[model samples]
Target chain A: MPAINLLDKFSRFSDQWSPKVIAELNGQAVKLAKVQGTFVWHDHAEEDELFFVVRGTLLIDFEDRETVRLEPGELYVVPRGVRHCPRTEGEEEVWLMLLEPISTKHTGEVEDARTVRTYDRL
Target chain B: MPAINLLDKFSRFSDQWSPKVIAELNGQAVKLAKVQGTFVWHDHAEEDELFFVVRGTLLIDFEDRETVRLEPGELYVVPRGVRHCPRTEGEEEVWLMLLEPISTKHTGEVEDARTVRTYDRL
Candidate 1:
């Protein structure tokens, strides 16, 4: 496959809270998302989730630990089974590149309206 | 684990062709590398590798395909069992973020001087 430009793939979509798949390797999916507001508080029972901020800032709130704030060029991994929620302060959307197992759910086991069952490939 | 800044991890190490592990999730290692010159031709037998360029340019030469060029904010994945080599055009150093299985060898099965046995965790 050809090289995928992160910015170019990001420019193709504008949906908030929805992540687009850019690439996959070693059973992990590489995704890009434009996020605002807050996501659901849930835990992946078997998969660690990687969050890499591409632009703006992201705040990951946890149920039992202190919230972690992520900035551009920064990355954080929420271990499996850790309850967490990701959000963006104010009205600005946060751009992110995420890595997770292909079987990971969007909202874990929680039934939410924003949960996406299938990720669209860019 | 704490949030990892790619640039901060990159600043702490100046070793060429060696990758520093910044994070690991789902048995995959997220690494940062400062690379110059050309790498040896090799292929992982059972693992795919993702290469995301942080700075400068990278050229991936394949055995049966045309070379792929990657730039900042661009990413490419080399499928498992594909013989490929990574290189740079000039003497300028290239910053890269790599994602691959933790068990993957640096130069695959190739025994080279630049091969790293154990990756330093940054």
Candidate 2:
């Protein structure tokens, strides 16, 4: 397989909060997404989600109202069954690398308008 | 858990080829290591290894003589049972983030002087 470039992949799509699969290792898939504004509060029942900030900044808010702010070159892992919502402040776009199981649902058990059931493989 | 800064983690250790576990998620461990010079050729029989270059450059040489060169922000995954060796050229230190099963052995089936049986969790 060829090398996956994060910047090149980010240029492929303009939609926010949608994740595009870039590569799969073992049973986990590596996805890239450009996010802005606020996402819905949701949690995966069985799969843990890993978010790596590639550009800009990201804020992950938990059910307990605790917020974890991540800058470029920082990462955070949300354990399974933990309710969390990811959002970004201002107008700056945040580039994120998400790692989770292939069977993971984008919005977990909550199916809202922003939920992406089928992700494009880049 | 707090946010994990890649640069801060890289600064905690200076040893080469010794992987330090930084976080755990979904039965997998995220490790960081600084490497320079060549490492022994080995392969994980049951686990696939994901290598993400955070600083400098890395050259992964396969047993078939195929080499994959990775730059900063670039990632490559070595499939299971694939014999490969990681090396770096010049005098620069290479910072790497490795993702694999928590039970994965660093040196695979080979045991040499460079093998790290125990890894420090940072």
Candidate 3:
């Protein structure tokens, strides 16, 4: 089978902060997510999340009061146990690949309002 | 800190078949490998591998007699336990991001002649 085209699959989804699994390797799940506005303040206590700007801009807000602005073609890792919230302005959408386990929730903490159980494939 | 720019780091390396650790997400390692010529046939028995072509072209040959050609700005995942070999012709270099564990070898099997310890960062 042909390799999965992440951008092509991402174009099929319009929901923000909803991440979908694109592929999995070695127990690590590669997820594509659309982001606008701001995500919840949570930290992956056991796993570091990778953020790749596939389309628009993404700002990774850290617990240290630092924000890393990511442009297209750029990627960053939010270290394990570090609190962060991602945000972008305007109507532009940000495409990201979160490398974690399939069991990982949208919010690392349980019972959050934005936590999603069933993932959508786009 | 700014997000890691994969292409920028790839520009610093000119050697072929050398994969560098760019970042680690969760328990999985994100590696940047420069590939040319042919790699040894192998398969990750424990984890699936992800290949994102940042430059040049890459051909993934599978044990099932299938071959997938990848171009720049494209990505593919080699499923776990699937035997495969990667190769490229000409002087063109292919930049790839391998999402596996730090313990995973270039050639998945033990006692391989092409195996290298201690990964370098580009």
Candidate 4:
């Protein structure tokens, strides 16, 4: 039998930044999302955020002159307490799985227009 | 800049079962692989092992008569102390990243045909 497609699961929903809970491990939530354009600059003070890209591209910009572009199948672990912003180039849609504490906020510290209120599940 | 491709990183080595160390976080090792055929049944007494599939499929057969099939982009976390066997159904190659303690063994208890030696780096 074929297993679940992470992107297909995201396609079932339309909310951005509101990651859907997929799996859990040792108290950490594994979330899948379909993201486009730019996300607000924020920081996860208590936990590191892992961005594993499944399709398209993403550029993670940190506050301190650190900018990393993620390609398909590449994963970047943003350490806890670092300020960062995410943006997508072109018109590509990105598939991402974030591993972190379940209570992590969609936007940290700076209140902005892109903060996701609630997380949805598929 | 484009980030490192996990599968391409595995292409830099030719060892089977012997996983190559990739990134590290909070003292945890993230190792990637290109696997085919079957892996020896094993159990990690302390740390859970996460298998994130990048290409093709995998059948994880557990000792309790339970089986879970994983496909591309789907991740499965094998809880600590659980014995399981992994097998590929066809000639397809599979990409995996195993997250566990650095001291964990490739094989659990039973002396098998697929015990890997020392881990490699790419």
Cα-based lDDT for every prediction: 0.95, 0.92, 0.78, 0.76
Across residues A7-104, which tens digit of lDDT does each residue of candidate 1 receive? 99999999988889999999999999999998888999999999999999999999888899999999999999999999999999999999999889
How much is the lDDT of residue A17 in candidate 1? 87
Q: Which runs of model 1 end up more than 4 angstroms from their true locations?
A: none
Local error of candidate 2 at residue B30 (angstroms): 0.5
Candidate scoring better on lDDT of 3 and 4: 3
Pairs with backbone N, CA or C atoms under 3 Å apart (clashes), candidate 4: none
Interface RMSD values, listed in order for every candidate: 0.6, 0.9, 1.7, 3.6
Clashing pairs in 3: A26-B47, A26-B48, A48-B26
Worst ten in a row by lDDT for model 3 chain B: B109-118
lDDT of 4 by residue, A1-122 (tens): 23456767777887666688876555566788889888888898877777888778888998786699888778888888989899998777787877776677778667877676677655
lDDT of 1 at B87: 98
Angstrom error at residue A52, model 2? 0.7
Off by over 4 Å in 4: B90-92, B101-103, B109-118
Residue-level lDDT of model 2, residues A1-122, one tens digit each, is 65566788888999998899988887999999999999999999999999999999999999775799999999999999999999999999999999999999999999889999999998
Higher-DockQ candidate among 2 and 3? 2
Give me the displacement of residue A52 in model 1, in angstroms.
Answer: 0.3
Give the distance in Å from residue A106's predicted Cα in candidate 1 to where it truly belongs. Answer: 0.3
Displacement of residue B108 (Cα, Å) in model 1 is 1.0
Model 3: how far residue A89 lies from native, Å: 2.4
Ranking by TM-score: 1, 2, 3, 4
lDDT of 3 by residue, B23-115 (tens): 776667788888778888888787667888877889999879679988775678887788998999776767787777777767777556567
Q: Order of all candidates by lDDT, from best down to worst? A: 1, 2, 3, 4
Q: Where in model 3 is the C-alpha error above 4 Å? A: A110-113, B110-114
Over the stretch B1-101, how does candidate 4's per-residue lDDT look in tens digits? 23567868877886556678876554466798778888877887876777878777888998875688887767777888999888897777777777766
- List A-chain TM-scores for all predictions: 0.98, 0.97, 0.89, 0.88
